[model samples]
Each structure stands twice: as structure tokens, then as C-alpha cells.
Target chain A: MRKLFSSRTVVTIIIAFIVIVGLITGSNWLSKRTNTPPFVQRFSNDLAGGVSRLISVPTTAIGRTANSIGNLLDTFEENQILKAKIDQFAQDKVRLQTVEEENRSLKKQLGLQATLTDFKTVSAVTISRSPTTWQSQLVINQGIKAGLKKGMPVLSGAGIIGRISEVNTTNSKVALISDTSEDANRFAITIKGNSGEINGIITGFNREKNQLIMGQVTSDNTIKAGDLVETSGLGGVIPSGLFVGKVARVTKDDYGLSKRIYIEPAADLGNITTVVVAVSEIGAK
Target chain B: MAFWQLTRIRVVYPVILFFLLFVDGAVMSGMGAFFTAFPWHVLPLATLIWLFYGVQFDVDKDMPFWIYVTATGILFDAYYTGIFGTYTVAFLIATMVMKQAKNILDERLLSGLTMFLFGILTFLVITYFAGYIIGIANVSIVTFLLFEVLPTVALNAFFAVIGYFPVWSFFNFLR
Candidate 1:
């Protein structure tokens, strides 16, 4: 058994250790990068992405069907609630159409080709979510081949959930807002304050509290609870006017020097099946 | 004349592992309602099960096996975790430690179960710790142990126990 620790084996162990270190450092490097990952990895990810899609699509469908059937008991109550909202929804639909027409005509008169809110969307299915707890992520089937680019905002039916962090040839990785990693990018956002628009970055996630903390608020605007928060589109990547969530609470940071606004995400981070990748014209040449 | 025997072990084993990995993702995809409180459910370790299943078979932890582990680590990084080196290092160390433990313990059904469970612990610890160090993972040690480790172990152990005999017999047949 001493031969297990022989010179050759020791050398092999050392080499293995070096490889591990290299891999870890490489991963950290990739995390900080906003650019597309390596070509070979892209190609490999494409192939695996295809296989995973094949497996997850059917499996997820089957599971959802089972889960929905189990929820049949609640549907009656839910149906009553929906039925109550149908008349209100029809009125809102007409109002929205009128506003849309007015806005278009105004933009045409102004000769504006595009605005911060103008965007095209490519819909994709959530192929998978990472099983590990630390990093909250989703693998969507849409990738670079589908005109998806890095930093594109991924929205669920409710609101923006995450942004495309890594885009491969045929698949991409969406880093969810729930991630608390230092390396993850913060979403540039604005809160609709009573005084004016209060701007900040969605800087941190408190998983235990189930709230997203918005920080870097220099403005002492009178922000209150239940205020609307949405994308400011300060950064060119995400489109403007995407609904983020309602302000859950507002508090001072640990130092008590600045305000931190906590938002309850509108996107059902857990139940996202299909997502829309919003491609804004701001940075696209 | 034939250098290759146990064709099923060599070829079919990986195929099954692949599906297991996919199923792992599928389980998480559907468990969205419970995502806020507990994001992951039943993190199916195909490699760990592969190890458990092959305990009775003459499965060598050789160069090819190590390469497969390394490859799996890379794929895991790119496809799932998106953090490149975490699994490569974690899986390599865990597999090596698991093999060492196997040598020390007698090959009984209970022992095999113990080793399998222990293997899961080692893998989870190494992975969680590695991710923590890299500043990518955000779960506190206490939280990691309570939420991630507890559920994962319970479910994965149940899976191992349920599949142990059938998998062993299947491998036995392959031989």
C-alpha cells in the first residue's frame, strides 16, 4: 500500500492538484467576463444543450401535467377570480390599444426611430436550472444562433427574472436575480418615488428574506413601501420600463449611511417555463 | 484477442449516467414553486450511482475513468453550474476519496450503502466549499448544511437504496 504514495503517484497527485487550481481560476475569470466564452466550450455546450433539451422538455412537461392535475382542486376558486377580472381586463385592453396608437403617432411626428423601451423578443423555453444551491441560474434553449447576445434581459410572464450571462452557439445561461455572487452583474434600476425617479442598482440578494436589495441610492427621495420599481434602462443592455417588482421595504444599510430598497421580484423565479429574451436597440449597431 | 470485455459497463454505463444528469435538471425545473425556500430537490448524482452500481463489478478507476470524470466536470460547469472549475476539482477529489474508502470497508450491502452515502457527503462538501472560496457561491455554511446537504442526502440516499439491488444485479449480468 506504500506504493500508493510512491514518487510516481505523488507526482501524478501534484499534477492533478495543479490542474484543479487552473480550472478553478479559469472559472472565476470566466465569471467576471461579459464576453462570450471559449469556442470549443461553446460548441460543446451546444451539443449538450441539445441533449438536455431533449431530456428536460418531455420530463418537465410530464411533471407539470402531474402537478397541474394535483392543483385541480384549487382551479375552481382561481377560475372565479379570473372570471371577475375579465371585464376589467377588456376595458384595460381598449385603453392600452388607444394609448399605444397615440404613442406611435407621437413618435412618428417626433421622427424617433427607436427608444429605450423599443425591443424585439425571442421566446425560448427553460431547458434547465442548475441543481446546485449557491448559484441561481437557468439554461434556455435560445443561444447566439437565435440572435441572443450576452447581457440580454430574460423576462418571465410576470417580469424580468435574469439576464443572459453566457451565450453559446445554441444555448445560453441566464443568471437569475436571486444570485448573491460578487461576480454577478447588478441590474441598473429605478424606483418610482413620490418626488421623482430614484435610481439604483439591484446590488444584492437576501435569500432568507426572499427580497432583492437595491443600493447606491444617493437621492434622499421619499420612497415608500408598495412603490413601483422597474428598469431605468440606464445601462444599454436591458430595455427600459420592464416591471421589476413592488418595494417590499426600505431600510438603511448596515453602516446606516445610505438607503437600501428591498423589492419583491414580480417574476416567479421558481415557476419560469418559457421566457422572452428582449433585444434592445440601444447597443445594437 | 478481445481487449474489451464488459461492453455494457464501458458504454451503457455512461449513457445511463447522462440520462440521470438530465433527470436531475428536470426535477429542479418542475420544483419551481418550492424554489424560493428550497431551490434544489433530488440532485441525482449519476456518477455517484455509477460508482455504487459498479461496486460489485470489476470497474476499474483507471486513466479512462479519470478522463471521463474530468470531462463530466467540464460539462457540468458549462451546462449546469456555469462555474467552470468547481465540479472538476470537486468530482476528482471526491472520486479518489471514495475509492480509498471502498478499499478500507468490506463489500457488504450495508457497507456499500454507507460508502454511497459517504460519497455524497464528500462530493457536496467539496463542491460547496470550493464554490464558497471562489466567491461565486453565496450560501452560508450553516444554511448549506441545513438546506442543501440535508434534503440532498435524504433523497439521494433513498434513490441509492431503491436502485442498489437492481443496479448491482444488472452489472452482474453485464459481467
Candidate 2:
């Protein structure tokens, strides 16, 4: 038998180690210089994502069915609640229609053309969530073939969910705002106040509390609880005026130099399956 | 070369590795949605099963086992999107260590379990340190161990216990 400490085996091990370390550092450098991953890496991701989608469909369906069956147990209570809210919904619908018509007329008089916020959206089903806990990301069944590109905003039924991070030919990954990973998921958000707009950046997510922490608000801003927060469009890729969430509370930042706003995300990010990728106007960024 | 040898070692082995990669990338993650309410996360490294098989059955001390480990690690890094070469290096080191230890380690249930646990622990520690050094992992070491490391180890250990015999039999059958 060949000796365990043979020169050939030792040299192979050392060379392998050096090569892997080189690859690790080299790939990181390449990825940083180019915003997109290399094509080979992307192709591997696509292959895995495609196979995963096939396996996950039945699992997702089973989960949904189980949830539906559980919900059936509370159907009567839900029906009663819906019955009580129907009249209130009717009144709000009429009021909203009137306000929308007036707003459209005002916009016509102002002669303002449709803005970047006016986007064409394509729907995609989420194939998987990232298995790692450190990052909050979703793999969706849409990609460059579907006109998806990096930085395009994604939304669920309630509000904006995240932005597309990497796009392959047939699949894309979205980095959720809740992810604490460096600058990738940061959002420039505007909190609309009766007097003026309060601007802040969503810095991190308080996962324990299930709220978004928006910081860097100037102390002079007249921000308050229950104000609506939306994308400010300052970041360029994300469109202006996509609803993010409502401000749950206002607090002082760690340094007390500025205000921190806690936002309750409008979308039930925990239970999202279908999402819309908002394809914004070209050259808007 | 015999047809059965070519098919088993070249075709079936790589196919099994690819399937495991798919399960790790897609199926485990799809299942993660159901565990959103849980505080701790459980990431199952299905590839570890194959790695263990490589260590146990690689009687010739050939290059195929190492090649499979490297390819599996590369595919994992591609799908995971955390750090590019973390798994590649970790898997290589783990395989090397396990290969050296195989001389002393017996091929039995308890020994198999111990081997798997040792492999997984080394993989996790190495990957975690590499990720932290590269700025991919930002959590404190304590928090990482509590939330990610401990749970992952436990889950993968359970997989090792239950999956060991079946995987062993399959590799034997292939031989």
C-alpha cells in the first residue's frame, strides 16, 4: 500500500488546498467587480432551480391544501366578519372611486405624464426560499427570458417584497429587504406625513419583532405612528411610490442623532407564493 | 472497461450526486417555508451522505471520490449563493480528514455515526469561519452556533443515523 504521508499525496493535498483558496478569493473578487455572477455559476443555479421547482410543486400544493383544510374550521367566523364589513367596504369603494376620478382629473390638468412608478408587471411563482437563515431570499420561476433583470422590484398582493438580485435565463433570485446582508437589500423609503415627506433608509430587520427598522430620519422630520411608507425612488432602480408598509412606531436611533422608524411590512412575507416583478421604465435609473 | 463498472462508477455516482444537490438546493429550501414560524433553522446537508459513502467504500484510494466531493461542493456553492468556494474547501478538507481517519475507524453503526458527526462538525466550523472572514456571515459566533450550527448538526446527524445503512447497501450493491 502507498504510504499515507507519501510525497505525491502530500503534494496533491497542498496543491488542492491552494487552488481552492485561490478559487474562493478569486470568485469573490470577480463577483464584486462584475455585478452579475459568472455564466457557469448561473447555469448551475438554473439547473438546480429547475429541478427544485419540479420537486417543490407537489410539496407546496400539499401544504396549501393542509392550510386550506385548517382554515375551513374557522369559515363561519370569517363569514360573519365579512358580512359585517361588506357595507363598510361598499362605502369605502364609492369614496375611493370618487377620489380616484378627481385625482386623475387633477393630474390631467397638471399635464404630468406617467412616471416610472407606472410599471408593467409579470407574475412568477416562488420556487424556493434560501435554506440559510442568515439571508432572506427567494428563487422565482422567471428570469431574463421573462424580461427580469437585477434591481427590479418584486411585490406580493399587499406591497413590495424585495428586489431581484441575480437573474439567469429561466430563473432569478430576489434578496428580501429583511435580509441583513450589507447594502444589497437597503431601500430608500419615504414616509408620507400630512405636512411633508419623511425620508429614511430601511437598514435592517428586527426578526424577533417581525418589523423593519428604518433609520437616518432627520430629527426635524414630523414623522409619526401609522404613517404610510413607500419607496422613495432615490435608489433609481426601484420605482417611486410602491407601498412598503405602515410605520408602526417611531423611536430614537442608537446614537440619538436621528430618528428610527419601525415599519410593519404590508405583505405577509411569511406566506408568499406568487409575486409580481415590476418592470419599470427603461433608463429610469 | 466492463459496462457495469462504467455505468455504476461514472453514470450512477454522478447522477446520485446531482440528485442530492438538487434536493439540498430546492427541496430542503422549499420545506423551509413551512418552518418560518420556528426560531431555529435546520439545514440538512444531503451531500454528506455521499461524502460518507465515499470515505467508507473508497477502498482503492482513488481520485473519483475526491472528484465527486469537489464537484458536489462546487454545485452546492453555486446554488447556495453565500460564499463561492466555502463548501468546496470545506468538503475537500473533510474528505481528507475522514480518509486519514478511516484506517483507525471501523465500518460499524456507532463508528459510522461518529464519522458522520465529525465530518459535519468540521465542515460547519470551516465553512462558518471562511464565511465570516469573507464578510458573508455577519452574525456573532455565539448566535451562529445557537441558531444555525447546532440545529444543522442535529438535523444532519439524524439524517446520518437513518440514512447510513441504506446508503451503505446501495454503495455495496454498486460495487
Candidate 3:
């Protein structure tokens, strides 16, 4: 015991502990920051991103091939189901086109250049998602050169999945909606109910239930299960009318003072191969 | 040390770790795609890092590995977690723990599994607390275990068993 507790050894232990604490504190500070990282950090991230992008070309190809094969088993039935929907969709398309044209002309007449729903999108391949469950981040191949700014909402073919958390020169990280990290940007969402649109904020996720927990709802609006939830665009960060998901349930907080709504996310947060980064046209000419 | 041996330590090990880290990400992408319901993830790199110390290197040869461990942890934090010191501190301490743990457990398959559990468990705990301190992690301990730790153990233990022999053979070949 005395040998183990030698003066030199004790000094070393204390120094190591201090170093560890400093590292944790320093890293935590860096982790929460959204600005451009140090040169060393950027260089390292770029190098890794380059490698992942090179590898993703093959991996994503293989993933899609495997996915198509899996979908083949259900294709016949899905074809039958889709054929029926296509006819209905064809009629809806013409009606939607007419309505859109009228709305566009009316907006032009009103001298409105951009609205909350105005945005442009850039497509990018997803190299990978962070292995850790807590992180819930996706590494995309486009970055600063691609005009991807921080806080840009990312969408899969299905719907909005997350927002850009970090941007490097050739790559960016999207913090997924499922991410429980405190630094993650919260999504301001609205649920279309029988009465009207009920607004709320996405706060956390219930991993066990596979549901997104929407909180800070002061409204007692009649929100039913299966109601379409979309970005309200109240915050002006995320575009309005972007499909988020349908309401899964409405429950009370533990204190019973506030309402907690659970959302079944539209995007398959589990499997994302490609995404589009939504660049808001808020100030764009 | 021979020139070749030094090269293996300085160059080969880091190169191999880089690929292994990439494999973790690649495996994770496929796993997320196919096994959507299975939230348990495999950290082969974490297991491999432990194998580098606990099973392969005697403590005397551990000096160089500290640098490797630190570099690897920093890259992991920068590349994936974005929380720089979380993996660095966790992996560094786990390697220190591995030195003691290696003494108690032989380098058999079962022992390798135990070490993997030790390495990953320590990583989760240290990182969880670090995340908590940094205000990132919000899940309860029970949720962490259920969602993160248990599934990682289940998958990575099998990975540890299968990977142990190859890594052991490689280390012995280096010897």
C-alpha cells in the first residue's frame, strides 16, 4: 500500500485527475459551440469526412440494392395498392395545380415575395449516422461549399428528420429529431386538429415508444391521434407546412399542469440514405 | 524495439485503428437500415482498443499506446460525438483499468468478452456522466442501460469473441 502510494505516484494521480477534468470541461465547451471549429478540428473532420464520403459511395449503393431486394417481396401487393391510389392522386394533382396557380398569382398580386413556407433544398448523400444512440447525428456529404448553413432543416424523402448542427468545408452533421442532446435545436411544430392548428415544441424522444415527445403546449385544443403535424414556421427558422408527422397521443405531464403530445415522426429516422437540406428563402432575392 | 516493430506501433496500429473506426460507422449505417427496431449498437473500435491493451500489450509497452488512445479518442469526439473529451477521457481511463483487469483475467474468449464489457461499460458510464455534466444526455440511468449499454454488450460481446482470435494472432505475429 505504501509502495502504491509513493509520493511520485500520488503526484501523478492527482495530475492525471486534474488533466482529465480539464479535458472534459474543455470538450464539453467545444461540443456545445456551433461556430466554426479550430483549424486542427476542421482539418481532422474534413479528412474523416473525405474518407467516409469515398466509402459511402459503395456502401449506399449496396444498401439500396439490398433495400430493393427486400422491397421486392412486397412489391406485388404494393403495386396493387399503389395503382388504386395513383388514379385518385391524378385527379388531386390537377386540382392541386389549379389551386397552387391561383395562390401564386394572388400572392404576386399581394406583392408578397416570400412566405414562411418559401425555401430551397439541396440534395446530399448521407454517409453515416453516429454509432452512439445518444448522439443521433447523421453525417452528410455536402457542407460549406454546398451552401449548407447551420440550423438548416434536413429532410428525407418521407419528411423532416433533423437540423444541421455542425458544418465543415466538405461535410456537415445533422442532429436527428431523436437526439436528446441539450444542444440540439428544438423544432416548433403545429398539429392540425378538428378545431384548428395547435402549436407546440418538440422537446424529447421516448425511445421505448419510438415516439417524439412534444411539450410546452399551453393550448387545451382538441388534438386527436392521427392528426397531421407540420412545422408551424412560427420561429422563422424552419419552413412552415413541412410535414413532420402525425400525432400519436396526447398525455399530461407528471405535474398535470402542462400537456405532452407524442408524435409518430413521418420520416424513418432509422434508415436515412439521402437527405435534402432546406435553405430558407426568408431574405433571399 | 526493432524498426519494423516500432513502425507497427507508430504507423500500423494507428492505420488499423482508423479503418476499424470507419468499420464502426459503416456497420452502424447498415445496422440502422436493416435493424431499425434493434437500438443496440456495436462499438468494434472500442472493443478493439481494449484488446490492444488488455490482451496484447504488457504494461511496460503501454507508453506509446497512450498517445494512440488519446488521438483515437479525440478523432472519435470530433468526428462523431462532437463532444471532444468524452471518448478521450473514457477511453484513457478504460485503458488504465484494462491494465489492472488484464492481470485478473486471462486472454481467453470469455475473458475477452468480460474486457469488452468493461471497456464499453466504462465508456458509457464516463461518457454518460460527461454528457450529463455538459448537459447533453437527458436519459435516466435505467434508460441508458436498457437502450445503450445492454444491446452494445450483447452485440459487441459476440464481436469480441469472434474478433479476439484474429487480433490475438496478429499481436502474436507482431511478437
Candidate 1 regions exceeding 4 Å error are A1-19, A182-185, B1-7, B34-42, B55-58, B61-63
Residue-level lDDT tens digits of model 3 in B1-175? 6677765544555677776676667656654666455354334354345444433445236346677777877887889877666777777777767666777889666675676567667776786787666555656788678767776677666656666677666655665
Evaluated at residue A101, the lDDT of candidate 2 is 90
Error of 2 at A212 (Å): 2.7
Judging by DockQ, tell me the better candidate of 2 and 3: 3
DockQ of every predicted complex: 0.55, 0.39, 0.44
Candidate topping TM-score: 1
| lDDT, model 2, position A150 | 78
* CAPRI-style docking class of model 2 based on DockQ: acceptable
Over A1-285, each residue of candidate 3 has an lDDT whose tens digit, in order, gives: 347488898899999878877877786577567556677887888999888776666666777788889889999999999998999999999998999899899999999988997899899988866766467788888989998877888999778889888888999999988777654547888899998878778898776676888986778678889999898887676788889899999999888888899999899876788899988888233
Q: Residue A58 error for model 1, in Å?
A: 2.9
Residues B1-175 of candidate 2: C-alpha lDDT, one tens digit per residue: 7776665654676777777766664544445544554345567677776777767767235346667787877776777663477777788777777777777789777876777777877887887677555555655677667876787888777877787778778767766
Off by over 4 Å in 2: A1-26, A32-35, A62-94, A193-196, A207-210, A222-227, A268-270, A282-285, B1-10, B59-63
TM-score of chain B as predicted in candidate 1: 0.83
For each model, chain A TM-score? 0.89, 0.81, 0.90
Candidate 3: residue A172 Cα off by (Å): 0.4
Steric clash pairs (candidate 1): none
Q: Model 1 over residues A17-135: C-alpha lDDT tens digits? A: 77777777777676567578778778877888878888887768876786688679799999999999999999999999999899999999999988888888999998887777567
Fnat of every candidate, listed in order: 0.57, 0.35, 0.39
Best candidate per DockQ, number? 1
Clashing pairs in 2: none
